[model samples]
Structure formats: C-alpha cells, structure tokens
Target: MTSITIDLSDSQFRKLQDFARVHGIAIEVLLKASLEDWLNLQKGDFVNTADYVLMKNAELYRRLA
Candidate 1:
C-alpha cells in the first residue's frame, strides 16, 4: 500500500480518533472505509430517490392549494 500524509484540524482529528475507538477499528481502517463510502456516494450509491418523490408530491399539493 502507498503512504500519504494529510493535515487535519485538532477537532477533526480528535473526532476521527474517537470514532475509530468507539467502533473498535484502527484509524487506518476507519479512514479507508470512510473514503470508500464517500467515493460510493459520488457514484450515486446513496441516492435519495424517496426524497425526490416526496418533493414532487409537495409541489403537487402546492399547485392544488
């Protein structure tokens, strides 16, 4: 694996460390999973189709009102 360096604010680093410990995972594992999830999100893996339908229904209601 390749190694890279990043800079995080104190609060962000603390939160990441806390989350890793609470989930019983290593910091590297947590970071990898988090990055994968973010990438998947960009790929539309976490689309909110339900919200779109609800918003359309709300527009219909507004038109009726």
Candidate 2:
C-alpha cells in the first residue's frame, strides 16, 4: 500500500485520536474505515453529500438508479 501525509488542525487530530481509542483501533485503520463509510454514503443509496449532488447530476448515476 502507498502512504501519504496530511496536516490536520489540533482539534481535528484530537477528535480522531479520541475516536480511535474509544473504538480500540489504530488511527490509520479508523481513517480507512471512515473513508469507506463516506464513499458508501456518497453513492446516493444512502443519505449524504451525494443526496444533493445526485439530483443535479442524475446522469452521472444512471446505472446506480
């Protein structure tokens, strides 16, 4: 797998760290899970940012519908 670096504000980093500890997972693993969840939500089959964009870009998700 490839590795990359991102910069987060102190508050954001702390929130992620706290969630990681609460779920008993490493920060990296939690981040990956979060990404998957976000992608799933954005597929429009679920509620998310995609809900709004889906209506405007109906053709983009023709197969999905």
Most lDDT-accurate candidate? 1
Report the lDDT tens digits of candidate 1 across residue range 1-65. Answer: 78899999999999999999999999999999989899988767336676677687997888889
lDDT of 2 by residue, 1-65 (tens): 88889999999999999999999999999999988898887675655665777787888779677
Clashing pairs in 1: none
> Lowest summed-lDDT stretch of 10 residues in model 2?
41-50
TM-score of each: 0.60, 0.59
The TM-score that candidate 2 achieves is: 0.59
**Model 1 per-residue lDDT at 39:** 94
Model 2 pairs in collision: none
